[model samples]
Target: MRALHAPTRRRAVLIVPGFEERKITKALAAGADEVVIDLEDAVAVDSKAKARALVVRVLRELDRDPARSIAVRVNGLATQWAADDLAALAEVSALDSVVLPKVEAAADLVRARELLGRHPATLQALIETPRGVQDIDEICRTTAPLAAVVIGYADLGAALGRGAELPPQRWAAIQDRVLLAARASGVAAIDGPHLGIADNADFRGRVHWAREAGFDGKWVLHPGQIDTTAAEFTPNPAAVEAARRVLAALDEAAERGLGVARLGDQMLDEAVAVAARRVLTQTEGN
Candidate 1:
């Protein structure tokens, strides 16, 4: 059976316009954990077909790194081009996953997989609309091989008619919902693309928020944002060491027939150990 987990870490996601072959080529070599060729918002309506064809050709031609995940963000399931996009992508064996935009229900995932035919690429859902967010629990509960769920912040904001600058608190609530559902379903949770590429300060703050809030990763629009995402998402040496200490403490407690232990000034329990192990898991291969 196909694995439900992602093939690699997803701390830094570099997404390029699918119609731009040069950009895609550059993205592949940009050292992001995942490179997504975007066929939806990034490509113009007239360029959709071209984007689809080019993405297939590029995936077929390039010698992809097995360690770095490669994905394609196809047009939304509601769009006219989605079926064709899925059908075309079925032939690209190198694809690790397909990011399905505006997924509102569990049925959408099943439909996308069917449209994709025999291709084994995993599905990543983009929750952009109110319906999508409302049905997120059901979407996550689906039996489909969903590797991750990403916040489509820009589109979601626009759809909610909240204008561009929605408050951080509101975004946090939405992100928490996505994160909770993803964790419960055992899938990765990704933050949406930060449009303020030129605003380094704001970008770094958002990355920090994502990390602290337990998001698996944040989307990095440019190579400049990549390093920041990588740094913030990757667990530091101290954190890894702390995780090891926590596990050791738990083991020691177990040997003593105790249900809890003390680590420095804090009390350690199974819950604490779970968090610590998660930190170490994030450090793997970093």
Candidate 2:
């Protein structure tokens, strides 16, 4: 099989489950890279079937473009509705991905793929529980067609008996593990949503932290967070130019039979070139 490419867009917004056509339309217009029609935590137990039906209809209508990158957040395998959810969505050819919640093992992803049948939808795992975190390496390595891995902070914090606010050091350790796991597995590592929606300062700080820690992007729960997330993930023009210079200097040095090059006062080598290439790749079309 060929390698899977990372998503070009950085922000993903989740719409509450069940039918809310107007809200979905507004979310798509909010400039998010993708819109996930959630059928898991957002939907109530009684509305599962209704939400499933509505998502199918929406997928059919939106599948026409295929470039819109629409996805569904299906219930976990342990739930009664999960099988039915996959069976129904399997027929939709336009679905770009499925967000599988409570994925604790590679088997969960394998089952999701089996139910998806011959469809082209990719799987994005939600690492929310302790088991999921512990088995993250195996889960990322074994799961095929895995596009991204997201840290569901709310559920994870709850599982760890952490309150609404987690200590910065503790949270950093968790985030770093997820980031490294995704990197080693060649998939995107997306930070979970920041619940402090009203606190712009806190939200921006979190976004900055995620970028510094090497996350590809973050989940945005509100429309207002879309631009913030996108801006944070985008490489600054100055940084991009500097990266270009690093590559140019390295290329010139290689031609001169030198293993290292000087960029300003700092020495540039293979290690620095890797980061420079990443900057160019991340900002390619931006």
Candidate 3:
């Protein structure tokens, strides 16, 4: 696969308390690019069924034109919550995707894809378990409506018995692994949030680390994290301007039917075209 970037807007997601219309509306108004009406961890186990019942109605209400896409992160199939989760999804037209937690292999995706019926709600395979990490590539590149592969690092850390840290922390390794798989397959990849909700410096550092690891965007667990994710993932103005130059050069070259060209003083081949067009696309999104 080739190196890649896309005209993606920042994917800052807020995990809201499920079964509640007010909380979902509040999170979206706070500027999260996507508000996840969570049926997984945020909803208590005792209230899971009640919460699941409200998801379809809540999504249909919030999922509006030019609004942030609504998603439901269903509890794992191994648990009691998944059956109703699938049922709620089948009833909703507003839901854009379903996030499957602790996905360990392609089979999990295959099951979710089947369970989603013929609805167009996409899949986001979350790689959080040790087995999920090991099977990251297989799970992420499935021939299904996989929106992106995401990481839940804090849970992953607990599972691995390690506190969160950067590179080589098993959590970071899997984050990169999932991103690599997503990029190779031309899908998207999102980084899990830094759990230090109050430690701004540390959280920003973690976001920076995720940026370098090739994650397209990140999960915004707290209200404070949303602005930072948007700022970091938005294409830099300088790069967007440069991409305009690249686009112009390509145009002139194409007029002469030339296969190779230069953007400013640099040669622009197929590889450069890919990277340059990404920036141009970014500019358009802005």
Best candidate (score: TM-score): 1
Q: Candidate 2 at residue 178, lDDT? A: 83
> RMSD of candidate 3 to the true fold?
4.6
For candidate 2, give the lDDT.
0.79
For residues 1-286, could you state the per-residue lDDT of candidate 1 as single tens digits?
2322356578889888898888899999988888989999999999899889999999889887767889999988778999999999888788889999999999999999999887788899999999888889999988788988999888889988875445455688788888999888878898888887653777788888888889888787888788889888888898899999999988998999996799889998777887787786567843
When sorted by lDDT, best at the front, the candidate numbers are 1, 2, 3
| Minimal lDDT window, size 10, model 2 | 1-10
| Candidate 1 vs candidate 3, lDDT winner | 1
Pairing residues by index, what is the TM-score of model 1? Answer: 0.88
Per-residue lDDT tens digits of candidate 3, residues 1-286?
1111112444577777786767767776778776677888888888888887776766556546454556789999899779778876887777777889999988888898888888777788877888888877788668787877888777788888876554434455566677778777776788876665653877777777777666677887778788887777667888887777787888899999998897657888766666677565433543
Give me the runs in candidate 2 sitting further than 4 Å from their true place: 1-6, 12-18, 63-68, 245-274
**Which residues of candidate 1, in runs, are more than 4 Å off?**
1-6, 247-270
Residue 135 Cα positional deviation in candidate 3, in Å, after optimal superposition: 1.4
RMSD of each: 2.9, 3.4, 4.6
Q: Estimate each model's TM-score.
A: 0.88, 0.86, 0.87
> With candidate 1 superimposed using the best TM-score fit, by how many Å does residue 197's alpha carbon deviate from the native?
1.5
